[model samples]
Target: MELDLLKEAFDRVAKKQKQSSSKTLDIVNQIEKEIEQAITKIQTTSNHTSVLTELKDKLNELAPMNQLDSNQKDINLALAKYTKLLEKCFQPDISRAYRNVDTDPHVLNEIISTHFYRQGLFDLGDCFTNEAREPNAASLKLPFVEMYQILESMRERDLEPALAWAAKNRGPLTQNGSTLELKLHQLQFVEILKKGNRDEALKYARTHLARFAATHKGSIQKLMACLLWAGRLDQSPYTEFTAQAQWEELAHELARQFCGLLGQSYESPLEVAISAGVQGLPTLLKLSTVMAGKKEEWQNMKQLPVALDLGREFQFHSVFVCPVLREPASEENPPMLLPCGHVLSKQSIVKLSKSSTRPFKCPYCPSEATISQCRQLHF
Candidate 1:
């Protein structure tokens, strides 16, 4: 476009110099005539003008970088447009969210995480056993398996005694145990960490840690996650472990976060034990897996220090790790979750409609958290 315009301007200048003095006035008249003819031709054009339009667009797009103000505006505009495109392309896919539960014998968190892990929507796959393998993923147990599932459910609820009984009764996995239990029940004794009470979870963890120590590496990771969840860096041995037990890297972070959680959570070791030990571990495993797999999600998980701290606050309060979306509007009150990804008081749930906001912002995520994000991930 500039090239064409320059050529036209040069022609006009050259023609002006050659014109006679009398014709110099005609030069103005001639230029005016040409400009009028150009405007008329533009108004009369009916055929497709794609080539001219595209050329003009290309020139406009090639704005000079020396115009710093314009350059910044264009960059900002491009970023906003790109972000909108990403949100449109990657909105969460909940269609298959619960599709596998009927057959998989897994927690709801797992279903959501595994399906969306690749897309960075959620992550249950990252929840590793002390062995560093995905926990009870395929439900491959037999015989005492049914008992294990009950134990898992009880553990998910932080029911220490119930979980312990299942662990002790079923005994260790190496003692020639049978493997005919249904899918959910097949989760092994390591699920002890899936309990809410660290004391209860430890009961099972110590037993499994000792019994399965030789064969299963996951026992240690389970123990560590439980210990971390229990808020017991000072007490429980939280070894650094992950897919391969990188204790050195994880220990300092664990200790630092433990102090933070202890200061903020406001709960007892027993309370922390139960939440992080049993209910919380499973939730963490699932939630972290989902968060870690995503490109920018890990920071969001980091920002959720308050959520970790809240577990400490609920001493004597039973911490429930469930995978369902509903908070189970009990007989006493309806369901409600707080802005920080925790549950609201029953009174709050009952009066939520009267509250000022609709679809509130979860202090946890960049966007408003759905009830789905708050779903508990039971053992």
Candidate 2:
């Protein structure tokens, strides 16, 4: 909405300037005509003083110049209004301050430096850590460096490094139900077949792809079919195996697995958070405006009035909101399952429990249970 307003203001200012320019051009043309007439009259007349007097009288009319001046003043007024509007639009940024969440500065710095590390900005991360005296940053560099090396090799269609990394981290990958190892080996096999190395490709597939036969039978069968068109894999029925996009996908998959093994995100969390924050900012600003007089309510509210839908990429996990409290569960107020199998936040459980002494009645059912029976539930 603000952008639209800015665009409208710009257009208005542009139109006003255009009008002023047109008026100035008209005034100049009229003055030139009057000068030409005066020159003609002077060349044709014997009495130069009278001709000059008549030219002066015509010049003194000055209607066109006055109109141009009026137009210019209008333009100036429009510009001033636009400038004031812009100032008003930007004023909220100064007046409205977000309530700080009490996050530790050191932790935030570490997170920011790690974000740089995850993005392969080793030099920048190093500079930041060295300048900030972060000891932990020293250890953070090597792992991401190695991960990037493997990823870079994968991008170059050199799968050896990726295969090695995947093999070394096979246990964790399997635990995460990732098929990156098989996919890497499959990519390697496809490259061999594309190069017309049918014998080597079959041997490699038998040696590596056989292990995943039970889990990826269809994919394995499709890979095997590529052998029939060894010399012309591009024209094969399973031509996707030979496409460069496959290598790209494999590289991304390998990187995702690598990060997953380290208990990190495939995309940088900092980026995701920023994107979500940007998406939610307009809503927050509007809400702030609506609650301008109610500063205490704005500051004290625990939950947002509207949900920010940041799409699938930004959603990392499931969120549970307590029906009774109508507030989302957090670490401090985690979801708890009652003995009767109904769930509510821990704080809600306490409220419903109403003093730890007596048996608490379940809100959903007639079943009664002690506070101890309400176990914390993890999502």
Candidate 3:
């Protein structure tokens, strides 16, 4: 009886193994048949457009054909080859495939879907190591190579140059232009910030947010988003930006949002850190004071980017709305007097105070103190 039972167990195991092997072979055969058919059709094709269409249609039908157990490596290899063929045939138009990943991006841009097939979208700022193993990855080779080296030299805090350049370049990206170029810029910008340039990253974000707001007036979300991004740059663009009327409102809004830490983390270098000369310091102090009142209101209004200039990362930092106060010193330079008890040869407090809303409160202390209560930091 024992001998008979052991023999029966062995027979059962053999049968199971045979069934598994059979299923795998069936799938493998299917894959080979499909690939052979595609290859023959592709070979007979003539026009590049026709070739691309055939390849695209076949991809549409057979793509993600991941069910075939034995065809995994073969399918990957085939896709690599197929993608390469299309790339070579339509050098400029090949990017049109990558366009939807950018062209009609999702509201949140989740970046994953059945529609996403191009491998280039994954090339987010990874340097080309010239891995001869896969020639398939050499998509972004051009003036972008020149720009990448330039960006590597700048400090993390100063990557705006790269983003600005990329944003500007997005305009002419078409059949003749390189989409990879702008893509590299956005990727590099994000990488640099994630590494260290947190402030610049915020600025990059705000600029994009503002540009979006201007384009899609309905997107209040984008407006708040700019505030959130600028909150990261914490460095004041107050003086330079406030020189214009429309920008003044945006600058004030941004400064208020940033000070409150809206849509940002305190540990993220979007800190309250700032640079203030005697003239600039008061504006910051006043801003701080004014913002102390309605902190929650600003926090609730995080802006989102509008669908403006779809491909280009729109980067207008401030919205144009209200007139700003940037009066020059009436007299060349005067013995500076301030309620802050600091003095310099900059300008008189009387005229400077006129630039603010509540000329009643000293910018430094919001105190009702006059020049009598002041001291001179620099004589």
Candidate 4:
């Protein structure tokens, strides 16, 4: 709805601008034509005084100044209206939303440099780190560099580099429930099959893919079925197996698994932070406006007054809300694991135990435990 309003305003401004331009152009052209005709008459005829008087009369009759003033007035009115509409719709002043907080410059520089490196912008990362006097930040680029190299190889349908990396990290990849290695082998087997080499495709599959048969029986069966349409998989019932999306998805999966093994997130941390900030900015701005006079309270707040829906991607951890108190757990009142395997806020446990002087029955079970038996849990 807001976009529609903006578009409507923009269209009005554009229409007015075009109309004003056309009108001004017509008036200028008319004036120029009159002046040219007057000059020609003056040059041909010896009556220069008469031509001058006639030209002066023609110029006054055209009234170029009046027409231009009218056009300018209309343009100014439209511009002023458009400017006000923009200001009203955008609420451009964001100064009131800002809150001053101290941040470590070194950490911020590192994050910026790391973001560049993770994006495969090694030169830019190096330049930034050098300019920031943190040359050690360049060390972060090596891992991402190798990741991109493998991705480049995969883009060329050569999965040797990726397969090697996957094999080297097989243990960790298995722990993380990743089948990147098997998927790479499947892509390779399909490539060989596309060459109309049934024997070689079967050989490759048996050598690399047979081990995954026990766990991935269904996928192995599909690969085996693809042998019937060797060199013509595109015409086969499993046509989707040859789609570009397969390679793209595999690349994404490989990058995800690679980042996981590096103890990093699949998405860039800087990108996630910026995206979350953008999502929550409007709420923060409104809250800042409402708390204008209570700036101290706003600044001291550990959590936002309202929940920001940053979506699933930004949700990195679980938020345990205590059922007994009907409030979320915080550092001051963290969730505690009771002996009965039920969880409750520390405050709720203290209240239930009567200040730790007595035992209390579990809120959800028949078992009882003292506050001492409840352990602090960190999520």
What are the models' TM-scores? 0.16, 0.70, 0.16, 0.76
Candidate with the greatest TM-score versus the true structure: 4
Ten residues in sequence with the least summed lDDT for candidate 1: 178-187
- Candidate 2: misplaced stretches above 4 Å? 8-95, 290-292, 295-297, 301-313, 330-343, 346-378
**What does the lDDT come to for candidate 4?**
0.89
Note the Cα lDDT for every prediction shown: 0.40, 0.83, 0.40, 0.89
**1-379: candidate 3 lDDT, tens digit per residue:** 6446545555555555566567667766755776677678678866556655665676566544554444445445545555555454433322211112235433222222101111222344233223222333333333334343433433233445544554554554333344333333333344444345556756654655445455445543422333433433224332222123433333233223322323322121211112112223333334434554646222222321121232222222422211122232223443445555434333445444444333444444655544444443422
Candidates in descending TM-score order: 4, 2, 3, 1
lDDT of 4 by residue, 128-197 (tens): 9999999778888899999999999999989999999999999999988888999999999999998999
Off by over 4 Å in 4: 14-80, 293-297, 323-334, 337-342, 354-357, 361-369, 372-379
lDDT of 2 by residue, 1-379 (tens): 9878888988899999998888788788888998899899889989999988887888788777678778988988888888888987764472353655789878887888989999999999999988888878668778899999988887677889888888898988888888888888888888898889999999999899998999889999898888899979878788877777887777777778778778888888888878887776767777777788665457577766766677887777899999899988999999998888899898887887787767888878899987888889899
| Better candidate number, 3 or 4, judged by lDDT | 4
Measured on C-alpha atoms, candidate 1 has an lDDT of: 0.40
